[model samples]
Target: MNTQTLKKPDINILKGQTITGKWHKKKYYVVKELGSGAIGTVYLCVYQNVQVALKMSKQSHSITSEVNVLKAFKKVQGHSLGPSLIDVDDYISANGHVYSFYVMEYISGDDLPNFINRNGQEWLFTLLIGFAKDLQTLHDEGYVFGDLKTDNLIVSRKPARLRWVDVGGTTLQGRAIKEYTEFYDRAYWQMGSRKADPGYDLFALAMVILRIYYPNGFSRGDNPRKTLQQKVQLAIRSQSLKQLVGKMLNGDIDKADQVKDYLLQYVMKQNQQTQLRQKRLSQKNQQETSFHPTLEVVSILSISGLCYIYMTLFL
Candidate 1:
């Protein structure tokens, strides 16, 4: 999430301004600035008595590319990985400067790292599993989440689902990645190219895991691959977890479904081991309970025999 720093927009000027769509004629009252990036600034706005996110950019082509990504996300069949595109139009500012903007579903949730910190690391695997499933769905549609990072992932409650945000980096298979953060980019690690592919996204996912564990983030050392391998070994002690991440980082596991299956198997194995330990402890308690009663009875009988012998001898 700390991958890149963007110049923030002036909230004092952006807030309280009413943006009226030039063609659609829809009005959105800007409540606050949500975030800003190289492409545009996203604002939390009120539209038709409902809160929504509005992204405004001076570049029309960038807006069109992002809109296309959002449209592609809608076709993933029953899964809304990113926000739904609500409205798109041009806006004329007070100075007559035109800007392209799009309104979308406002996802009210925590970013992945903050959500994990608040809820505890126990939710880490479940959240990663959700990411893998969503990635798999996107891959099945012939697209890759080129910039998969903790900053781009949000964890929404009510059902606690993981969703994608800021899909400006999404690209069709075999194309150059539209955008990326160096920390999560394969090219930065010198492991692969910046081409849009399943392996590229998987590598980013591995970096996301490292970011979660090392919230302070890390730098690429003299040996980038060795540095990453050492960091992974330090953070992950579980053999299965380490193996899955290693596969992703090494480009051995390119398919999202493969990563998902590996994680499920690891979880199932852990559950079984937990149940076995509980069963063994229960049996040990039962044996101890039965042995205590037998010991008490034998001690009482020995005391009674000693008393009778003493009385008979005295008589």
Candidate 2:
């Protein structure tokens, strides 16, 4: 095969291509394309028995922007709420297109956005609680998801999974952002004009939760709730993302500490219960194996008598 025969891909090769459904890598067969974005395209791929979602850059250097961010997330402190990147690969396509690919656990289920679209306001708080639990755990581990957008967040039912997809090219190490920027307007994004801080991250999450609660005036006015149905509707739509967030940062909603306290209490009670159960089981096992002299002697004598009776009858 003459490698030179392939046409060089520039603006023309990928011109009509949808970001979501092209195969640059064949080591794993791409089942189908799922979604697309400005930076990369996502494909549902299969590797043996495992089903995974793989993403590759449409642009050469931009892929590194996301890859670098994902690498940082890997170092994040606690239980990351999303799928860990299993592999990152780079190769040339048939059109002489150079690409870098990222493989991640294809989270099975609908996203939180879709859920919000289908469900009611009642689910938002419950979902946010789980999300906060997972996110704070990640921050405590000294890492941020970079961009905390709803598109980057995947949700499941019963057992909630905030599948953290990687950085949306949003990376700041606790001291980079300074003041307001256009990007910081989103409920989960912070535009720091001075420096990046974990506090900003909390503010972002609060913004996201509040948007779920109040969509209309999350930025300036009230969330536009005239009726119960409208109020419920507001709870589901993801709005002005930027303005709602700005409003939230300026507002007086305090959720971080409260959720933290609740988590501590819940974790402690669970540990105590686990320990008590283990201790009781250990005691029971010890008693079962314990040597009781009276019972042991009776058991020996009964066995000897039975053996003698059998021998005498045989004789």
lDDT tens digits, residue span 97-201, model 2: 666677777877666656765785445555655766766665555554445555556675457655556455354556443223222343323223334445555
Q: lDDT values of the candidates?
A: 0.87, 0.55
Model 1, TM vs. native: 0.85
- 148-213 per-residue lDDT for model 1 (tens digits): 888778898888888887888999999999999999999999999999999999999999888988
What's the lDDT for candidate 1?
A: 0.87
Q: In model 1, how large is the Cα lDDT of residue 113? A: 82
What is residue 292's positional error in candidate 2, in angstroms?
59
Give lDDT: candidate 1, residue 35. Answer: 82
In candidate 1, stretches whose alpha carbon ends up further than 4 angstroms from where it belongs are: 1-13, 281-315
TM, every model: 0.85, 0.56
Model 1 / residue 49 / CA error / Å: 2.2
